[model samples]
Target: MLWRATDRRSANPLRTGLRWLLSLAFGYAGYRHLATPAPFLAITPPWVPEPALVVAATGIAEICGAIGLLVPATRTIAGGALALYALCVWPANFYHAFAHVTVGSTTLGWGYHAPRLAAQPLIVWWALWASGAVDWPFRTKARDG
Candidate 1:
């Protein structure tokens, strides 16, 4: 069956809101990644091959996924892709935190790093929920069992 924002029994305001918000966030981040990749490059793990190419590819992926999230036909796949994308980039986040990556003479403290690391899972969840891929903590039991 084709998935849509209203695929559930009723419309979910929270899901709609998160979908738009995440789309905007990813779209902007994608633009920034393409426009200036220096910061991203700084945090990239040494093991990654062709950091520049990967950064550019990620930018394209982000932009495409962000656009896909809004289209009913592609929303589910987009959400899944984005969730995986977020997971894939986590190593860079860890590198940034532990390596004390400096971008433009500014090294983010643990205060910033900690919350960002913590938010990764939430981001993954948001994409899934917003795209109607899975609903948890909000799904009502049938007849209260």
Candidate 2:
């Protein structure tokens, strides 16, 4: 087994796999946010004071959080930070959904955007759970012997 059977410190394979997948996703998304930012800028709410700066900062945070998630020592902190980051970005998702933001030939309509909005909390929870930053109802049982 990849994870230790008796060692509580070693996360189960499911969580580990989820962690890696989320890290990769965040890393790639971050790169996209920086490398080609026009789409992101288009989705930025007009109410935001400095859209470009926020985009850049969020990209940087995503990349850093991705790296942190892979390191055991930093995993929990990274998870918490990522959870907060996801929450912070929720408004942008809402803006995109409501504004019907367009990028190239594709306009993000309600059908495409509503599910993403609904999934935001799951993303945050995934980060927290995968990194073992917060596990309540899912806590494992200790050996009684």
Candidate 3:
């Protein structure tokens, strides 16, 4: 088997495979944004003053987090990185929350930003929990007898 039969949450190859798939999804999305940093950059405040460095660092962090999530040895680090990334990008989320954009002529409502903002903490929590950073709720019994 490609994966170990450890804790129930991570038991068997199927579950592990699913995890890798999810990680890949996040990684790819992050990569796309990294490849074209303009869309995200335009939203930042002019006084923030350092868009290039911010974009580069965030992109690298996302890419690294994605890579780390795939390997078991690096999962914990990945979780930490992801959690931090979520916190870092929060300002953009807030900007989107308050700013209004008109598409052609229709003014869309502000509900969309909720999900994006909520996603940060959710991803952070999931990454930490899924990576086994803490003792799982249903750990397998240790066979000492």
Candidate 4:
């Protein structure tokens, strides 16, 4: 809590590598959900209209963000987009946790989905920071005494 330099470096290579791996995996999963009617349907709340279209858009966003992270010029945008994408699907994750969204007769518990979903923003931020998309905001400032 006293130094701003704690976050002075860009993401380490191993961590950055992991970020890309996670991004690729997540993007693929999103694409799968978009491709299959059953998975897409499972997440759509009754209140939502045009569930298929929404799923497709989400899938596209995931793909774009995953690709964006690979390009330095687009890394920041990708991170931001990924974060936004995570927020967009939050309701679906919540619904699943509460059993409001059922994938077949199986519903995923919060324990399974929440940590990764909830950690997404931090992940995005870490990726962007690691990719050197921007300066770390307050490593020293926060620790200033």
Candidate 5:
């Protein structure tokens, strides 16, 4: 099989730890987005419509996804959703990087942006892996018939 479902009984400690870490990270970020939207609003791409509403909605999504990750019934869907969320927000990262969008008076240099941009894919993969949506590079080959 190309992908293996995660078994809670055999769950990897590293993966579980990372999953909890991601949940905390996303949850906190969601709270920040809701409580103080100015930074997010500042980074929003100019072409996006209703930036404020979009920011608010994304915050809710992050919070929901974070919560979903903690529930076994919702983990897979949460992983997929969070992965897609990371992909969806990529453009904003780009805009921030290329346009030099400043959050408050702090203008982030490429040093910060480079790693973040590169890490985006890792984040998506992390969500998928952590939530058991996919198991790759670690899945064993099936026995021959």
Candidate 6:
């Protein structure tokens, strides 16, 4: 089981709002991936054995994770899963940065890629925080039993 805050009673407005916003973003991105996978395929690492299948699977997972986040019953599981998913797919981000891959006309450079690479942890934290999987500032360390 993934780490989660013990205090489920406390639900902050800001966190909830951010979570919803992210969900919308993910949902849209997922839809785009399903509708037009060419851009995603462009970012796929050359080493990947089957880029098309991977892209489709990742897109489906993202959509599911986004949907899971909205439901209170499955929020924690969804959060943990999404965090793991982000970690798993980070290689693509790294490849994009290192290779300076371009989708259509715009090429991704250090300015865009560096921050994206650096913000991965932040993305994981955001997923956890927004899903109420891990509370911070208000609560950091998990409660000791």
Candidate topping TM-score: 1
Where does model 5 exceed 4 Å of error?
A: 1-5, 142-145
After aligning candidate 1 to the native by TM-score, how far in Å is the CA of 68 from where it should be? 0.5
**Residue 137 in candidate 1, Cα distance off native in Å:** 1.7
Instruction: Candidate 6: list runs displaced more than 4 Å.
Output: 1-10, 140-145
Q: Clashing pairs in model 2?
A: none
lDDT (Cα, tens digit) per residue for candidate 6, span 1-145: 2333423522677877888987887788788889999988999999998999989988899999999888887888888898898898899999888888899898977888889899999888888888887767456456533
RMSD of 6: 3.2
* TM-score, every prediction: 0.92, 0.88, 0.71, 0.71, 0.91, 0.87
- Superposition-based RMSD of candidate 1 using all C-alpha atoms, in angstroms: 2.2
Q: What is residue 110's positional error in candidate 2, in angstroms?
A: 2.3
For candidate 4, the per-residue lDDT at 36 reads 76
Model 6, 137: alpha-carbon shift in Å? Answer: 3.6
* CA deviation > 4 Å runs, candidate 4: 1-11, 113-145
Q: Which 10 consecutive residues of model 4 have the lowest summed lDDT?
A: 1-10
Give the per-residue Cα lDDT of candidate 3 at 98. Answer: 66
Per-residue accuracy of model 5 over 59-138 as CA lDDT, tens digit each: 99999999998887788889999999999999999999999998999999999999999999999999998888877756
List of clashing residue pairs for candidate 4:
1-143, 2-143, 3-139, 3-140, 3-143, 4-139, 4-140, 5-140, 11-130
lDDT to native, each model: 0.88, 0.84, 0.65, 0.66, 0.89, 0.82
Model 2 misplacement above 4 A: 1-10, 140-145
Q: Note the residue pairs that clash in candidate 3.
A: none
lDDT of model number 3: 0.65
Predictions: Cα RMSD each: 2.2, 3.8, 4.8, 5.5, 2.7, 3.2
Model 2, 56-139: lDDT tens per residue? 889999999999999877887898899999999999899988877788779867778879999999999988887776665576
| Residue runs of model 3 more than 4 Å from their true location after superposition | 1-9, 12-18, 101-108, 135-145
Tens digit of per-residue lDDT, candidate 4, span 29-137: 6778667768777867666778888877777877787787776556666766776677777777666666656677776776777785677667656655544454457
Candidate 6's C-alpha lDDT?
A: 0.82
Better of 3 and 4 by TM-score: 3
Candidate 4 residue 136 C-alpha distance from true site, Å: 5.5
Model 1 stretches with alpha carbons more than 4 Å out: 1-6, 143-145
**Clashes per candidate, residues 3 or more apart or on different chains:** 0, 0, 0, 9, 0, 0
- Colliding residue pairs in candidate 6: none
